[model samples]
Structure formats: structure tokens, C-alpha cells
Target: MSVSRCDIPLPENFRPEDILAFHRRDGERLAEQVDDHGLKKGLLWRGLPSCLELRFQPGAARLSLAIDGAAAADDAGRLASLGRRMLGLDQPVEAFERQYGAHPQLGRLIAARPGLRVPQTAFPFEALAWAITGQQISVQAAVSIRRRMLQLCDCRHSSGLLCHPDAARLAGLDADQLGQAGFSHAKSRAILALSRDAAAGALPLDAWLDGVPVEEISERLLAVPGIGPWTVSYALLRGYGWLDGSLHGDVAVRRAMQMTLGLPDKVSQPQAQRWLQDFSPWRALVAAHLWALLQAGGF
Candidate 1:
């Protein structure tokens, strides 16, 4: 099959560093390892120095953008829209400050980080699959599992990008093969069930981002086999950009929040809910900021 690519102009302030930071936070580097599994590389179109090369696979998509500091004059409106969508410009920073003022530490920390918004990403399947790979495992072990899964199931695009396995591909695998790929029995069944459901159109994983209520979406996600609160919450934040979905049960998040808030011990779920009340509609962004802070040695 022939490959196609398209380029879109990015906003003037679309810094590569910012994209790198968000991608790093969402574990995009790990996704890259699985790119050759089944992802397809499409056409290459350029908008002169500020173009984005779009890649579309069966169940995932990503754009490789070339940041141009000098091309700001060419695509102002497009850039503005991109900026609004990506930088949380739609959110009122003042409102965020007003609501979170009681937790000065959280507010001050976010204020100091200008580019702390959760990135708009297109690969829900990749995000979900990664979350499963991470279940009850260390980050290093999760990475290894993901790498092995990709190696076992991935196909390469002409551009050498590794595409993650499609649902049909994964659904066809038996339990033993999945176990050989290092997936525990429960995880293997869950992954296969999700893949089969996705392939059969039973799960509208991609459509939940279109202004659906957070609780509704969370409930639907939880109905899937093997997906729990933490998985759904992570998906809400990473896949659909639901800012209010606080992942209170996440070990890393709980630890980070405790340290950041100077709590003597890990905050309980109820306490976390109360503490996170101020973040409200933008709690996901706050979580992203806290994660970044944790990674940077603040926690």
C-alpha cells in the first residue's frame, strides 16, 4: 500500500520543548518503541519550516512537527487555534488561581510552570495498551513488557516507524502467546478482550472526547474488562483530556501529592478528593504539573 503524509502549520509559540515535555509525561517515548508494530506512515506535505508530518495507523495517529521560530508570520490564525487547543488557553488562569489559592503550594507550583498543559494526543489505543502494560509493575518493567509486546506483534512502516498492534492482530493471539510476551494471565485476557471489543466496534474509544461528561465516560471505560479506576482515570487524563479526573489511587500521584503538600503520610482517597477539590475542572492539568514536579525532584 502507498503511504500518504500531510503537514499542518503549528502556532508560533509551539515549542518543541513543550511537546517533548508532554510526550515524556505521557510516556510517548515508550509508544515510539511500539511504532513499528502496525502504524502506517502517510504522505509528506510541508508548510515551509512550520509544517507537521501526520502519521495515521489503523487505530492510532500522531504528528511529527518541525518547529520553525522564523515562520510565525505565515500561519497566525492556524497557530492561534492550535495554541488555544494545546495550551489550555480556553481555561481561565485566574479562575484556577482563585479556586486553588488555599493550597498555595499547588497553585504556586503551577504558576511557575508556564507550559504545563496536558497535550492533545490521538492514540487512545496506545495509551490504553500502555496502561495495561504498566499494571502492578515498575516503570522499568512496564517498559520492558511494552517493548516485548511490540516486538512480538508490531509491523514496520516504510518510514521505519514502528506501529503498535491493531486490535484484530492482538485479538487473534492465544493466551499462551500473550503469556510468552510476559503478560500475566489476567492482563492477557483483559488486553485481548479489549482488543476484540475494539475491533468489533463495541467500544467507541475515540468518540468519548467530544464533550461527554467525565462521570459518564469514566463509567463506560470501567465497564471494559480489566479496566479499573486507575486505568480509567489515566485514560481520562491522557486519552480524552478530562481535566477533572484526578487519579487519586495512582501510587506515583499519591506520593507526589503527599510530598508536595507536605502530608506526613500518603493521603487517603477521601482526603485526596477533598484536597483536589480546588483544582476542580482543571485537576488533570494540576496532576500533570505535579508529575512533572515529581520528576524534577520537587517531591
Candidate 2:
């Protein structure tokens, strides 16, 4: 197996654990996908022919990134880019804390985990596929299904680490085929349809959707079979690193907001949307940190 290693520089106040926390929050093994250390995320970089298993660790001023089983000779640049994006290395560490860090609810978690950074996948297609698989289900249930589906269909490197399948591979499967892999009819159709679009180059891939108007991008992705407001917002938040996307419709978002604000019951979607406006520019960070709060037992 070919191995390539690089040290990607980080912005100030970056902590590796802060980003890995998001990966571990579900607590279930994604078909033995995530463990105590690094995990796999798929990427078809510059036509590498197959996905590389990327595992990274954060350090004092840089991330120690390794790509095990990579085939491309010049894949280092792509790996560095993905490392920066996945680790939230571009974020100004103190900006959010400086602005809303002292708030009664948000402050509790922020003060304790000052380095909690919002992490994203290396690309959009995998994030969208995961969002579809995870829609409207309990985290435990969704992860169970994902674990099954990935084990059944995704590509695995020699290390036994699997990468979520690419559009070309997934596009060829029928809904009935995916049904056997723990997908509901709706999710099956969504996955197949999205895969087809992506494989055919009809939908945006990776950073292609970046810098497009949020409304325009939303319209395009919502046109997919299973994408909705929550999925779109969730995808944009992690997929494009856009902090403007709100998690108002997410169950976790509502639950966290309710407990943080001490509300009697779950807030309505409209209420959640309006309430999230309080965090406005940092809504995506707010959502990640709120989810982190649950993992940290703050709520």
C-alpha cells in the first residue's frame, strides 16, 4: 500500500479533539468505521481512480495528516486542502467566543471547550448521502443504518477502512438493492437519484457549490428526491462551510435550544429559526457547539 504524509498548518487555537468530537458523538461504530483514533472519509481526488483512506491528528501548530493507500503522485495538495477544510483550520478561533461566548447558555459549553471547532467532510456528495440516510431518525438508528449500508456497498482500503461510495458507484444501484442494505424506500430512491445526478455531473460536487448564492444552491439541491430544508441547511453547513445555514429544523437543534433557553417544550420550527437568528453569522458554529454540548453532557 502506498502511504503519503504531510503536515498541514493550522490557525490559532485549533484542537484536534474539538473536531473529532463530532465524529464520535453518535458513540456507535459505523461498521467499525470510527474508533479511538482517526477515521475514513472518501474522496475521488483529481481522478485518483479509487478513494483514499485519510486519517489525521491535530498537533501544536499543524495537523499530522496521513493518506494510506493513495495512488496519485501529486495528491499532497488535495490532501492538504481537504485537511484544512475538514479540521476547520480556516476559522478565526476567537471570533465566535469573543462575540457570544459570555451568553448564559452558550457560555457554559464554550468556556469548558473553548477549542470546539465546526468540522466538515472533504466533500459534499458524502455529506448529502449521510444526511439522507440520517433524516428524521434517531442518531442511534441512523448510524445503525449507515453502518450497514457502508459495509454493504462502500469501497474499502487495505487497512479495512471504508470510504462512502462515490456517485458513479451508487448511481448504478436500484432502490430495491439498497432496500436490502437497511434503507427505506424514500431514502433508497433519494440515494439512487442523487447518485445518478452526481455521477452524470448534473449536481454540484465538492467545492463546486461554494460561493454560489445560498438560495440558488438550495433550490438545486432541494430538487433532489429526498432533500428538504433541514437536509439542505445541514448539507450547506458542513458541505460548504457556510455558517449562515441554520439548523432550526433539526431535532437536536430544537432540543438543545429548548434546554439552553429552559423552554417548557420543544420549540416550533419557526421559533427555532427565529431564535437561531440570535446567533446569526455564527449559526453553523452554534449548531455544532450545541450538538457538542450534548456530547459533553451539558444538556
Candidate 3:
């Protein structure tokens, strides 16, 4: 195995642990790759097959690669690119703090957390499958199923790391096959539909949209069987890295908002939207902070 290394810089208020908390809600997340040190390692892509070990420093981020041979050498570039994208290496941390650091409610969170950035998946389909499978289920349960599904697809990286299932492989399968892997019938069909569209290049990934309204993107995604507002906002928030979205529809988000805001009952979806309006252009950040806060028992 050949090894290579790359370093990515951390922006102001960078908190590596916060990103880990957001991405790794449970220790057993099948699609997530984080070690005890918070270092993450996984394949560049299912096809590329190289494994990248990601470590973060206070001032910079480091990537270590283990490649099979010359065949996987070119994939190093792609590894770095994905690393940059997934880690939000270029996210404007101070800029957001400067904007919302003084807000009465969110300011407390900003002051408490300091630097928390929204995490994104290395692959869009990973988040898509997560969104659909996780519907009405606990995150821990969804991660468990996600792992079983990847094992069924055999999407392990060449360097011996688990990764999300590839769209092409999933697109060709029947619901029963995925069902055997622990997916609910509805989730299996939904993932299959999404995979089929994505594999056929019919579905649009976040990268395909530039300057597109968040609602418009949400509309396009709704055309898919299991895609919904929560999924769309989640995909945009954690997958696309868009900050102009919300987790209002999510139970955890609702609970977090209620507990934090001292609301007596769960806020309705529309009410959640109205509440999150003030955090426009950076609602995703608030979502990230809320998630991290919950994990930290900030409530």
C-alpha cells in the first residue's frame, strides 16, 4: 500500500470536535468514518478505492492516504477535493459569528460553542439514503441500518474502511434485496428510486444547483418518492452545506428549539420556520450548534 499526505487549514473559531459531534451522532454510524482521536479515514470513492486518513490540527487539517498502486494515484486529487468539501475546510466561521454573535437567543449559543460548522457527507447519496431511512426513526437506528445496507452492497474502501453504498449498484437492485439488509419496505423502495434516478443522472445533486432558491431545490427533490421538506433541508444543511435551511421538521430540532426557547410545546413546522427566520442565510449554523448543544447537554 502506498501512502500520501495532505493538510487543510482550519478557519477562525474552528472546532474539530463540533464537526465530529454533528457527523458522528452515534459511535456505530455505518456511513461515518471517525476514529477515537477524531481522525477520519475512508475511500476517496467507491471506484477510486484508495483510503484517506483525515486528522485535524488546531491551525490546519491533515489527510493521509493509502493507495493500492499507480492505478489509484490520480485519485489522490479527488481525495483532497472531497476532503475539502466534506470538512467545510473553507467555511466562513468568524463571518457568521460577527453576524449572529449579538442576537439575544443565538448569541448565547455562539458564545458557548464558539466555532461550530455544519458537516457534509462526502457523497450526496449517502445523506439522501440517511434522510429517507431515518424518517420517523432514531438516528442511531438509521445508522445501524445504513451500515447493514453498505455491507450488503460491499462498499468497503480498498484500505479496509466502511463507506456508503454506491448509487449504480443500489439502482439495479430489487426492494427485497435491500429489505433483507434491514431496510423497511418503504425505505428500500425510496432508496432504490433515488439510486435509480441518481445512477441514470436524472436526479440532481446539490452541486448541480448554483444560485437556485432553496425552496425550488426542495421542490425538485420532492419529485422523488420519499423526499420531503425535512429531508431536503437536511440534505442541503448537512449534505450541500447550505446555511439557509432549517431542521424545523425534525423531532430533535423541534425538541431542541422548544427546550432552548422555553416553549411549552413542540413548535409546528410553520412556527419553526417563523422562529428560524431571524437566522436566515445561516440557519444551518444554528442547526449545527443546536445539535452539538444537545449532545453537550447545554439544555
Report the error of model 2 at residue 288, Å. 1.4
lDDT of 3: 0.71
> On residues 2-119, what C-alpha lDDT tens digit does candidate 1 reach at each position?
1223334433333344444443432444333223221222111121212334333343234343443333444444444433444343444456656665566886675666535565
> Against the unseen true structure, what C-alpha lDDT does each candidate score?
0.58, 0.70, 0.71
Q: How well does model 1 score by local distance difference test?
A: 0.58
**Candidates arranged by TM-score, highest first:** 3, 2, 1
Please give the lDDT score at residue 124 for candidate 1: 60
List residue ranges in candidate 2 displaced over 4 A. 25-73, 207-210, 296-299
Q: Write the per-residue lDDT of candidate 2 for residues 141-241, one digit (tens) a residue.
A: 77777777776776664445555677887887788778987899999988888889888888867647446788888898889988888888878777777
RMSD to the true structure for each prediction, in A, is 8.4, 3.3, 3.0
Prediction 2 global C-alpha lDDT = 0.70
| Leading candidate by lDDT | 3
Give one digit per residue, the lDDT tens place, for model 3 in 1-299. Answer: 56766777777567677556655664664445665456554544535455666777778778776665554556567667777777776567778999988987778888998877666777777778778878888777776777777678766666466655667878877898888878888788788888888888887663553456667767778888877777887777656668777777767777777777888887787887788877888776777777666773111
Model 3, which residues run further than 4 Å from truth? 1-4, 22-33, 44-46, 68-76, 204-216, 296-299
TM-score against truth, every candidate: 0.72, 0.85, 0.87
